[model samples]
Target: MPNKIDFGNGSIDFNIETILIKKNNPEVKKLAQFYIQLFQNPNIQIQEVDKLEFTQKNSIILGINERRDAPDRYKIQVTPYGIMVEASQVKGLFHALQSLTQLVKLNPENKAGSIRIPTVIIEDEPRFSYRGMHLDVARHFFSVDVIKQYIDLLALYKFNNFHWHLTDDQGWRIEIKKYPELTNVGATRSNTLIGHYTDRPVKYDNKEVSGYYTQEQIKEVVEYAKDRFINIIPEIEMPGHASAALAAYPYLGCTWGPYKVANTWGVFEDVLCTKDTTLNFMKDVLNEVVDLFPGKYIHIGGDECPKARWKTCINCQRNKRRFNLADEDQLQSYFIKEIEKHLYRKGKKLIGWDEILEGGLAPNATVMSWRGETGGVEAASQNHDVIMTPGSHCYFDHYQSKNPREALAIGGYTPISKVYAYEPIPANLDPKFSKFILGAQANLWTEYIEDEKKLFYMAFPRAIALSEVLWSRKEDKNYAGFLERLQFHLPWLKTQKINLTNAYAELDYTLSKSGDDMVLHFVKAPIKGKVLVEFKHNANNFTQEYPKGDSLILSNSLDLKAWYQLQDNSLCKPIHIIYNKHKAAGASIQFIEKPSPKYFSNENSIINGIAAPTNKYSGPEWLGMEGKNFEAIIDLSKSDTIDQIKFQLYNFPAAWIYPAKEIIVEASTDNLNYEVVGSWKLSPFTQERYIEPIVDLKKNKSYRYLKIKVINHGKIAEGSPGAGHTAWLFLGEITVD
Candidate 1:
């Protein structure tokens, strides 16, 4: 990720027999020890020398120079004598060591008991100062040791900020000295959710899930991160996502009396009431939190706070009138501003989710835009600092690939390529507002990630690609070169036993329509490999080995799989595709109302000859709209006999997406004077998969135009995910036969 680099003709051998510290700085020596431990050679030893000895070819010289330019800029020169790393600051020196670790391949065995180091001159610095990675431990608590391992990985990639989400409705993972019950009651849930939240007849493990970090443990982690030059930004959710706090002390709730820690995930109606007692309680908690974390900012989660309770509470209504607030949103804003004032008085800034921008943004608040980039762009335009963590590209909890072997993710497709393609600054934003755009961070929400190994599997390789996005210049980015370098690091990660996903090696394909045939184009991999594709078309099976970018034409419905076979005879995981060549396949279609942008897919997904997997409701195969009727017209290009019309609908009420209440199918000869052919009322049911309802026509009829109208389920029923809110309607591929 260096800005400038020049490769030399040959490589030099380094034994690492000793290291000479230019100023004898204890911090530098300590960091050298940490970097040396990464080597595979067990017999390696580090001895500090007063002066650089040119005779010792295996020695590394670390020098700190006076700051005359970028404090994080570092230079590494590998020549015949030895490797010398020079920097204006310790941060730059650490970056150099990280690069050196890659250069030596973790000190692989070489000739004459020395390691072959690439001979090169490199200068590197980060593109953004606020490079960060967020971990949500509240959903699933990880031990302190595992947290340190995560920090180590972040440091290896030169991340500066670690956003530690320590509190949520699921559990509170940080200890407050003044509030003993916060850990005793709020840290434990009665039981954990057994499976996907959308599962029908919800089940639980019936085993207690609990954990919390004592103040001493928090201090330990802070110091550990400090040693690696990583800032730990502790998040203490407030106003919203405060169910755990309310459960700990009932006085914080408007209803008062009793509340239990949420055993399940999603937004809750019970939030901290806007009262003096709750404000003081939150200020006290932040006092303890700010004492533990030395970072300048504290993330006060202000996202997804339902106002159901506030709408009925007398005290909340009184406060609303007293403050002359327009609605519940303004009340929430006032609540956040009060907290921000307290933090500012304590010499700290405030960070909140983009929801804080609802009524009025805090005067001095940094926004973490998770829903999308619109909020970030708005905040930046208002001259407020914004960190772009849009869920589309940065939510690591989403499925990284569509492969069946992948673990259960929250849902959504965010391949590593999409993450790499992300530009922290949106192109549409004005250049003047770019300064307010600090950087971007990836969030690893742990609702689905249960253990440390799964955590690493979800982060790695993708995290590596993110490091380049935040460090290297945008114009200088070369994914092909990054892959070549990543190939070297993957082996080193294996030697260290890091669990990384192999989706990076899988072949990526694009689907399109061409004259009644679906074309699947497989892009070539940068590494040495051959694409192995197998598919069935027209009742004929075909298998072939394609050495490069190749296109396959599918003329009929079938299951297809494609994978990469490396030169070492190892196979990368294959991606499975299901094709459904119905009468409407490759036909022209027009939408009466477009789907919501929040859950949009390809425009032609409905007629692309592919059926959406029932397991996932979001991705390239489904289009979703909120409380809107689905009315579409499909032209078959020529009159054809049609006896049946079928389509799939998602019914995950837990996500507020319900199946259509009724479907009406009509046919026309000249795109006019359509006559109803069939109508069926549906019984929507909550489940993990979609429901395919077929409408059998009264009799066989030939028509060139088909008009399908679907009635959306109204508002979500009480006690549902979005109770009383407009329900979502997700439609899958359409089939006319």
Candidate 2:
């Protein structure tokens, strides 16, 4: 229950009156400064002591021994007499200081109070050498001060790598001395997209915005992170997502000049020209990057480079022939290999997104897998070092809460639970290549994160979970215990001024169905704090806790909200789950045509009695049909009188999820012949909105088998998220009476 004290026997119950430093090291002095800043009593001071002494009163001992076995390992031994920390490296000492900071508890007055900590001999070191976190400043530029704060947070958590994403399609965020236009033109954008990329007819703010890091500023950040034992790995995007660089220098583009920095999100066709001149430009930029970062790895972004322009460009086509490349993909492989060779000349290893694995991987490239675990598995199997940063668990831009009231996110749900549950190492990976799997990283892409506050909101809690994932051994993780510990750590984040999501009011509920009988199960979500839940059934509102060891058997519709009382004596936003009762609520429903992989996994979702979650697309729920009509057979088991059937569909034009063309429900007493009970011509979706289509049942029929058919919208028109691709028809719970 006490702040995790790793090792020792006796307890140290002394107030910090003074710190006796055994070494006159700058890092050790800085550690003392940080400790004083954190627990400022105005009475404590640091004194240089010649000999090591363990006094009981109010003194702390800090010592450095060069003969220590572990270079970055620290030891903190506690006794009733004194608290002593010993380490051979600054990294270990800093970690010991971090532990010391945690021991300084906040008192009732919100001031720091020295307390007794368990006297455990803590000898700790990082599990992985490359524990890292990534930030995409190109999407939305964060100031130098903010970047330092991010690094500070990482250092506090013992994360040692800072992946600075400095270039992307949206903007160029690093200064290149040779190319003044890079910062002057590429870093500046006319405006930004006003909503999620899935929204059709994208709107812009129409305001000029510009930001870039100067060489001096970059040096400051590098030095700042270095003090915390953090390595800054600068990322320079290439080939694809080079709209900004091309906009600055028109000749770098495959097409003509006069390209503007992309104000929108997502991958674009415009790319860096595949020529000697372009290669020179990249090498020049990377040369400047090399001078800035001391880390051994330089990230040349080899992800999401579109080949459309390359297909048309004469120079690219000529290069394809020159290298005898099979296709544009192989051309990309050529590009990456060339750059990797360039970086090798500069004594740095090339690291890239998993997309670099396409066609053929470079001889010594490190892969950062973002799409899924398969890329990491594939890369590692080939004896290449891989960093497992799969988006399902590591993307902080995704929504953390399932509550619709959450801020507009890029999309997809990645709650703290999901991040904490992720295992970076793939089970299918060969044991011979297991050593190639370095570690994992969580990325904070800033397309929707305009301010530092919102950015921290998205990164925190999830990053905290990822920290444990990357640091602790796989078998040591326990969610219930973690939740308990995190509850205590929340205040520390507040003290550090982090804008973390409370999620206390979010509700997690499930529907248990047996035949026609249905029961509602509910619990507080996210933080899972103390909750009092209430439900409204059939227009009657019952406000109180549900009975213990009992479930609510719903005769009709069920509406539930789990409310968590905050410190202000008011409930945060209640997580709302609204479900309508259907005649076939618990009936066995099977889809004749399987749903698309993009939108489904669990086949029981259609008959689980739970409706589709509203916040995002594609969870374990929501059966979606792409370019195929949804035909479902529901077995009511026995003959029952049915009057009306109702179902729901989604309409998001930007995502290419259109309203179904039509819906027809037929009932049959036997398995063969069926009589039409309800039918409707569903309206086309011209805009984005979720719709629940209820076709009034006209015929009164006694039936055992109900066949429901929902027609897909077919091909989406031009200018949608998946334009020219088959529109998806998403089906939720089908309720028949």
lDDT by residue (146-197, candidate 1, tens digit) is: 9999998898889989999999999988999899999999999989887877
lDDT per residue (tens digit) for residues 187-249 in model 2 = 999999998886756799978878999999999999998877889999999988999998999
Q: In model 2, what lDDT does residue 229 have? A: 82
lDDT of 1 at 297: 94
Candidate 2 structure, TM-score to reference: 0.90
Which candidate should be chosen as best, given lDDT against the real structure? 1
Against the true structure, what is each candidate's TM-score? 0.90, 0.90
* Candidate 1 residue pairs in clash (backbone atoms < 3 Å): 15-58
